[model samples]
Target: MAEAYLLEEVSNFTTKYYADNLPSVHNPPPRYNVAENESSLSLFQGQLGSASGATSKFLAYEEWRTIMLYVLTNLKETMSYIEEFIHQFWRRSRDPTSNEIDTLLKQGAGSGKPDFISWFKKKIDLTEVFGMEVDNEDARDEVDDAKDLQILERLHLDSDDDIPPPSDNLHDYVDMHDIDDETHEPAIIDDDDYF
Candidate 1:
């Protein structure tokens, strides 16, 4: 489209005509809170942080002003094209005698059914894009319990069965005093309190 507009065959006025009009067909007004100014960006010049396409003639400064030429030119071209397109489209769609425009204004398509389905799916815990974990923890516990019962049954322990005592003297020997072989006394900490 741009190429055709720029070519010699297409009359400059006609190219301008289409360029002026297309937005009336497609463009809907500000959704997503698109502010005209999308906040400002910062620029700094350092040994490593040199501005692109800047030569030795460049200075340490310029800031937003440096890019303003390129930015404004591009913005102007883009906005002119958009407005021109809207005008051209309006010209095409409406009755020539009628002053009113035949614009295609649109509203939100109501995110209802898909949202409800998604919510229901999440509530039911069915499938996810990252699929749901299929493991049943309760089932695993039941299996473990059954295996334990089987092992106990195989061991055949009578109601009157007696078990042998453990050999490790649990209470027979207490933790003895930390002492020399010749002398036995608990190791004491040097503190303010007299023990």
Candidate 2:
């Protein structure tokens, strides 16, 4: 849950930064702001700490500022990677003949889908970045659960068990000859004409 919260915080920060500051050839890259830094640090209250002592301790002001700077820098870099991936995906999806996306799904080298969460794990080791031990097993379990759900969905789609059986009742069947050809209503039967 903490990992999810951290990711959400990073994503929210990235979104707000982009929304507030639009890219331009004329203007310089967005400069880091003290208020923004403070806000980001505030989100991780007890999570940020120091390891200088025998036991971990809460970070001092200077230490916190330094750590927040590092975090922000990494966050910005990660956001850039995500933006690039999104742009690439958009470009690829627009081109009908593009098989570059299919390559990501191919077997062997470079197979797995482009997952930002995994990318984040690779780029920034949460344990080192946050100065705390992270349990990666939880992440693995979540992935397993997702795969299970997908497998179940595929199984459901392939099976015909969910479809109801055909009805055997006589009332359920209708005869086409009994209906009028013009109005498509049931023909009125006259007993005298038949006799």
Candidate 3:
């Protein structure tokens, strides 16, 4: 039940974020149109059509990158909160004063598993939820991908429009050091190489 709740909360968070920030096709801004490029996989893609009727893909990518960074920032906060809550719950469940294991043992809960550790192992399985395998180690790939997105480089738009300065307190919430601190450059890709 907790696993289901967690998944639902995460889904709602992601949905709400995009709904609030990215404008819909029915209600686009003055200069920008909700991007019509179905091939573009990036979130919050907006196209600013030139007077010549030429659309720049780079502009859409740039805008999407900024919007995605904001969403990632928000997701980081949400994940942190959820992680803290999980930690608290785990700590409380294992606290000696709680006597959870004692109560379980008193009720003769263990069948073949005699010890608390063995019994607890049977109670919770982190491997899968709702038929889908849940792997925490998958975060390694996400970290690598996030490092690829250099927020500093994409912070401002090239257009004449005024870009709001990123929050000074962003450092408090976002750890820029998640990727290697010494390297500031993005990974170079060969002409033939593709992700």
Highest lDDT against the true fold, candidate? 2
lDDT of each: 0.33, 0.42, 0.39
Q: What lDDT would candidate 1 get against the real structure?
A: 0.33
Over the stretch 131-191, how does candidate 2's per-residue lDDT look in tens digits? 6643333323432333333333443322223222223331222454677889866677799
Candidate with better TM-score, 1 vs 2:
2
Model 1 per-residue lDDT tens digits across residues 1-195:
878756645554344455432433234333442334433422222123323566555544344333442353245333443343334334355433322311111111132211111222222332332255322222224323333334334434232122222233222233344433464544455786676
**What residue pairs are clashing in model 2?**
none
lDDT at 93 for candidate 2? 34
- Candidate with the greatest TM-score versus the true structure: 2
lDDT of 2 at 169: 33
Global local distance difference test of model 2: 0.42
Cα shift from native, residue 16, model 3 (Å): 32
Stretch of 10 with least lDDT, candidate 3: 113-122
- In model 2, the runs with Cα more than 4 Å from the true position are 1-42, 45-78, 87-111, 125-195
lDDT of 3 by residue, 50-154 (tens): 556655565586476555434533454334433432342333434433355334333223332222222222222322222443232332233233332243234
Candidate 3 at 13: error in angstroms? 42
What TM-score quantifies how close candidate 2 is to the native fold? 0.18
Off by over 4 Å in 1: 1-74, 92-195
Error (Å) of candidate 1 at residue 21 is: 43
